[model samples]
Target chain A: MTVLARARRVREALLGGRNQTWHATEALRRGLLLGVGLVVAGVLAHNVVLALLGAPLLAASVLALSTKPSGTPKVTVLPVARTGEAGETALATVRVDPGHGAELLAIRLPDKGNPGPGPVHLLPASVAEIACGLYRRAWGEGVDLRLDHLVAGPDALIVHGPMVGREVSRVLLPPVRELPAGPVPARPAGLVGVHRSRRPGDSTDLRTIRPFQPGDRMRRIDWRVSLRSNDSMPYVRENHAESDADVVLVLDTRFDVAAEIADWSLPARGAAVRPGGSLDTAVRAAASLAASYLRQGDRVGLVDLGRPRLYVRPGAGRRQLLRLRNQLVVCARSAGWSSRPVLNAHQVSGGALVVVLSPFLDDAVVGATVQAARRGNLVLAMDVLPAELVAEPEDRWGEPVRQIITLERRVRLDALRGHGIAVLPWSSAEQGLHVLRPGARRSR
Target chain B: MGRVRGRGVPGWRLRAAVGVVGALIVLVLAVQGVTAVLIGLVGFVAVAAVALPGSPAAMLLIGVSAVATAVLPGEPLRWEVLVLIPLVHLLHLSCALAAILPRGGRLHLAALRAPVRRFAFVQAGAFGLAGLVALLPSDRADPVVEVLGLLGAAGLVLLVAALLRDRDRVG
Candidate 1:
């Protein structure tokens, strides 16, 4: 570019167009006025000491003002990962090209309940680049970052923008912990599956000995049974075939009651998942269950009772597990308090094990779980509600309110058990799975 | 672009430097008179103002100190007065550094090089002028002519500043 063109561009950048402009900050204006006033006063009063001190101030202000900052520097923030695993660190870099005359660059990132790296101030330089590191502490889609860039001129006399930049949205996947494989259905479908099927086909386990049919394999015939029969009829041994079962995870997103006593009174948005909140417990448990079932070569699907639109078809394999995890984050993100919770029968496959994860705060969730169980699906209502309750301080009738809610919740859970649907507290997941075991009868 | 971060001078370090300079100024003033010490205390208050990241109170205090020194009864000219001028300039520079830099901001030695260089030039000029003034017979120069000379110098500085301000760019 020609020198004249370069100069023109610099002027335009300093003056700014409609969208961007350079303006003096309060500090800068104060410095300029004070510097001039003191120096002039020193000269008029014939005080050499004062003039000497004031001269530098005046010189600094003039020098800062004279050096017009180079054009409005555009800040470019690199794209961050769309999905992050809990405890994983993700980096986002912001670059300012040809960063001439930028005295200070202030970069602000987003703040959720979890502490994020604070704003960084880069010393003035020709080219500045800042890399922000974010730590994913919890599950669910957290609005991780919104970049705000502010550029100050020399001596910070002139500043342009605290311009709001693009917001970074990150979906933090729930950490899947080690969970023991739960009980599988007695009657499984499909040719290749993990569970044993009652209907004999081709498997290692022996089923029953019967007279050889027309299509019976020759190898399956039991010679001892045939010799004992003495009726000249060969008996064929049948083996139970191993098959896979469908596990449909039903997430109740109506209300996320925090387990912590102190967080009960906080605003719902911030208090939605207080580390060990009911929703957090549900999401984590659901993730663990899905991973365990999928690892067993079983088809797993997901259904959010709060949002019917988000539904995952029954699928198996590693890809399905990833899809289910992503969906879980979406499910938790939209798991706000709802008045009416919906659970459709189409969401559950016949003979499928339906695990309904809910705090059971609302009677509607309890009704949905019972309805699913009654429809011939084995429903396990995982009570994610904390055992103890803490009431808000300002609530005058906190004790009475707690007592009433607790009493109602107990009755609802009893009703669910009365309908043969297994009501289990999520805290004791092993006992719940034991209850669902077909061969191993539960004592309860 | 690659990641880049520069550490400028630390705030506390610069503030401590200014505090030491203030203590020296107080000691000098105490030797002069109790009234001068009181004036030094006032200047210290202004130093407190400059310690804030963005405040102009330092300038007012500097003006007050200059007036106090000029009007005070003393030997018409002294070598100590010349030394005090640059020392006061240094204090102002330190205060400005403390004020302009962000809190906890590390001062890049590179950034300080230019300002410190300019300050050295200004100090050299001031010392040269003081030397010439000291050579003159203290009783020979008329007080009116001395004031006129100071005004002429101030005018010359204003003219230079105006010319510099009009320039399209600062080098």
Candidate 2:
């Protein structure tokens, strides 16, 4: 058979008779032909028993044809949850208001018949709601589940559609691990925030005890200190003002290398980013840190090192956290190398904690991290490389090649640490940042 | 991609069940002196009916057996015809459904419930008619009844054609 004929046969087997309203099947013809032929032949032979044998099929044909399903079936596809974390299974339902005539429904779903991915499902039309478990393995914005459906009439004698349902595109956010919250370098400007500021104000942290100021509240006075003074000089305690920190999450989208050393050179195949790759790790790490800082009432922002157009300005609140996470998705979606990683000093304030998340595959990112450090910003270089490297099985020299690459990368990371930049690998990202208590990470 | 499937009846199980029914009917017809060629024909057609239900082999399996009963110069009111009537009808009904859902498909048992129920109802009515037919004198040759059966068959074929044609036009 020709390829077209073969495809049509396969399609009919899967999704019965596409795009047409319910019509007769081959069985209908078989029944009518065999039934009438047997009855007529029996009469010609003057045999009453022969005529009786054809009665059942004749009755079946009439019964099947009589069921004329009335209304046009309307199919509605809805995902119970539009957004979910990567690797999470979400439920998507395809509801068919089979109107009057539909008997069977054939929908494309991720089912056993289709061994690879999503494909056809044949079920009774009475089942209006078909809940399919849609799993998105990769991160970022893309189509999660697509329902291509059709309807068949009674006895599967007729069919109505093979219409493609609207694609259930969901924003599969990169999974955010609840990392330990760490203090960011608070910019001296903001007057109210979680961190203690140098300028004395109405925070609970006591800065010092000195002679009572004219504007000091009565609550600030220390009665014990006033009693201790022989000169009758009253002393009041001073508290530091609270300030919010600007956390610029810098993502290096240059190299999205996976753990497999062999696949490192390949562009992302059939996926936005390679699963467990450098870029995937970076996006997840950025989202986690953003959530952590924003939870602590600090201003969080995003800087896409490769594509500057995707930069999210520093803002505080729950919404900023969401925007930062979404921008991280956009970064993953359009991830590629542009001009070398950019981190101009003006992109962030003087004391903003610039957490540069990269795989450390190149010195350019290391140099950018060091440059931000030199610009008086507390820069933390987050190495988001996959923890384990897998060598190609067939290649004899693969292990040596991976070893050489590993040694070079290790030296690069060590160089960044030597420049006073805290190199926090993704595995220990939040843990190492906790050491940057206030002025600890700031060299100047 | 998320793959989902529920508890289902395999297509082969239905085919095999009907194949057994067809085998019984074929064996009953094949027992006319129980020849080797007849036995071979029964075996091949029975397998084809299940393996390729939509193919001409299924039609031949039922058609050849029914024709053999009529042409074998046997008594018209034998116990064999009564048994063949239900078994052959069941095999045909199963093949029709099995053709729609091949081995590649996931067949839910519920999908077959309606068709089977209808088959049972139709079979009940057919048995009632067969019981009535069983009372008729075997020696009687009614010319008027034969003419009426021929006319009814012709009218049915036209009516079926009209229904199918009307459906095709609207579709």
lDDT by residue (tens digit), candidate 2, B105-141: 5567677777888888889988888787778676756
Q: Candidate 2's C-alpha lDDT?
A: 0.75
Interface RMSD of each: 5.7, 4.2
Best candidate (score: lDDT): 2
Give me the runs in candidate 1 sitting further than 4 Å from their true place: A1-32, A62-68, A72-74, A77-79, A92-98, A109-114, A122-132, A143-147, A158-160, A260-265, A268-272, A392-396, A438-444, B1-171
Model 1, A212-255: lDDT tens per residue?
A: 99998999999998999979999999998888989899988766
**TM-score of B chain for each model?**
0.71, 0.81
Poorest 10 consecutive residues by lDDT, candidate 1 chain A = A110-119
DockQ in order: 0.22, 0.30
RMSD of each: 6.2, 6.6
Q: Give candidate 2's fnat, 2 decimals.
A: 0.35
Q: Write model 2 residue lDDT over A314-355, tens digit each, in one string.
A: 998988877788788888877885858887777887789889
